[model samples]
Target: MKKMNIKKILVGTAAGAVMLGSMAIPVLAAKPANDVLVKNWFVYNRSSDFAKLWDDNKATVLDNGGVGFTFNNVGATTWYTAYLKAHYNGDLTGKTITANVSVTEDNATFVTRGDGSTSTVGIVIKSAEGNWGVNDYWWPTNRQLLSALGTDVDIIASTSDSNRANWINICGLPATDATIHSGPDCVGGTYPAESPYDGFTNALKNVKEVGLSFGGSGYARGVALTGGTASFQLNSFTVAE
Candidate 1:
């Protein structure tokens, strides 16, 4: 009976240890279901005030090439910018992503400064920035989109200028949303009527997220005062998932 009692006590202790260990394992290894997932779109439209600065640079960037404009006093200068707010379901810290930006302008103009007399002479994505600038004329000084994503503007093609008839496609992951601006006014003096692309799209390849900036600056590029005059429009934007 004494031996049987000792054996029974040992068995009970072993069972208790096993049960405790099982409970602790789950507590230590379990993770919440909402730990990883991102969902949110940061979109900016031409209508948004972000495009205001483009109006100033219209002269040098766009109109400088001898484009036409509705606002005569609008020198050949225009400035344009964009912003996006994406809701990463999870933490976006240390994630690699690629964004494809498409821009179109209507009734726009262009002035070829460098490489004088080039077919497609117009504003290029100087760099992507996180925040909006004071006006389209001023370049974004903080949190540059290119510096963040570690890439530069990759211009696939550009069609038309100084009118609503130009198309631009670029690929890269800006550290954050992109603020694209262009104008022809490096020589000072204010220009007005900076128009943005009719539509804009932002895509994150790593997480598979896409956002459309339609109503505000819409997902469109802006027009400058370069020359030429016509209603600028952006075609539907497409991105590979």
Candidate 2:
């Protein structure tokens, strides 16, 4: 793996001081009121007000240019999802997003004792058709990393107006599973509807937010992780072109 040089930029705000990292350049002045790309990132731990987790010390900035979190006793009814939205008001048509993501189980209990179908970690891109009424989402399929020792993958998504969105797996080894196979080769199905936004490309055309998410529906089906820890990391997320 190549070494990543991530810079941390701290700015003062009415709420206090905020830390922004991995930006192209550091802004020494006061923070802007609307920094869609860097600010307003919150962790949703099975609740609508997941943003509160930021202040609770649940999310932390890793030393290696990434964000990390630990979940304990998380049930099927609840999961973790984190996102950062762009502050711009224009459409994201013809744009692409890329990132290096990794997820690992600190212990083997979940793999050895569980059915191996109960966990998932992935990248998600969300977009709204118009002003922000209904939204659509795109992400990688669970089979892409279900049975692997951990996740270390590079994912790319390109957007278009129609169902022309594309998700490519640049490199990395992902585990495969037999069940939950209903979508593209490595990409997952689009949410709400699958007809027009069958692939990730169409969903990306109007992207409003993007981020990483961990958790699966397998727990609801009786598969549980009684012991072990899982960590999800995003080295960086940037506009591809």
Candidate 3:
């Protein structure tokens, strides 16, 4: 509900990639590691606030030593992988993705990035503009990620130092193309949905910028303190064959 005083803004690219500044990002010819998925990223709070970044409080590290994300309600974060640029716009057709999310009882009631409050975990695929597959959970009711989900069960939540809300990615994208979103309106179906190759299918094939969304409905920061500070973390995210 609260907005942040952002200093930096993410610059969109023709390839649907996002850089820290408005400048163009150079092309990369790197490849994935043996045991890891990605090594580079375009990490930022959805708010693009640099207040936290001015200091040494950067985001956490991914499993393969890549960049991950961290933020509060006023500084919710998103980590868009640069694998597309590095690999000439790669496609995640048959690969499986796995990751862990850290949630707190204080954030159980807070809905995640989506429309109106129909928050869910979004695994977006894009190129200039694209679609996403989601796991739309009923806030305060859905306990798939965190036990909180507005239910306040706090059964299997996560913390700053730990991540328990794991995800296997099971959701669907919109019927059209998009880069930014308020949130999802429909229930989750299947990620990287197969078919017509005009919506989700298209985005997955020409993947330019894939987003790992875990912020509040409108980039609300913090994940604890009952929404005082929207601190959240995603860890060990990996895509493998």
Candidate 4:
């Protein structure tokens, strides 16, 4: 219920598509602009604690692998747009985007170079200019991106081992129905019904808008690196606000 310290909402990827209309693009310089829809993104591949949280906060891993962090909000302070939001189902209106993730340590061979070695974590959101389906929220969904602000709500991490199970997600409760909160069990114990997104807790909360197309279950098993190749890479992305 309280443990959201995920460096407070993440970001990266070309200043997140272009830091919101760049200073109101000349003071509403014409009006008719409010397109912001940087959908849900919770990527955490190559989760080895991400180079000690980017060298204890030296933050700066660009070239395509986006992984920067800095904030101030409103009056002063600049540098927006984060990463990981890939999961679209089509028709992303207007356009100003960034979303893609990948991971492959020992799926068997592991040889994904370039942006191929795969291993990028995430959390990026932007959508204000042209607004076309806004509402993005996340909270510990699974294991990587662990913080967010607006839009319905999102959280994951409890696939349920029962009781004090780790975590689990799929929110948006209220109208369209969406509720899957199985766990308090970390000290307690007893809250299992096989819930990862199933066991029916409100099935995906019926997420309204955003790319839509994410796939990755929980895999636990490390320790077997002979040659090299501990994959997990999800290039940066953005569309500021």
Best model number under TM-score: 2
What C-alpha root-mean-square deviation, in Å, does candidate 3 show against the real structure? 15.7
lDDT of 2: 0.39
- Candidate 1 — what's its lDDT? 0.22
Per-residue lDDT of model 1, residues 48-84, tens digit only:
2333432221211011111111212123332322323
The all-Cα superposition gives candidate 1 an RMSD in Å to the true structure of 25.0
Error at 12, model 4, angstroms: 10
The count of residue-pair clashes in candidate 1 stands at 81
What clash count goes with each model?
A: 81, 2, 25, 45
TM-score per candidate, in order? 0.22, 0.49, 0.39, 0.23
Q: Which candidate do you rate higher for TM-score, 3 or 4? A: 3
Candidate 4 ranges beyond 4 A from true positions:
1-98, 102-175, 178-216, 219-228, 239-241
TM-score of 2: 0.49
As a whole number from 0 to 100, the lDDT of residue 190 in candidate 2 is 22
- The residue ranges of model 3 lying beyond 4 angstroms of the native Cα positions read 1-39, 47-58, 62-69, 74-88, 104-119, 129-196, 215-230
lDDT by residue (122-178, candidate 4, tens digit) is: 232222223222123222233332121111123222212231122222232121223
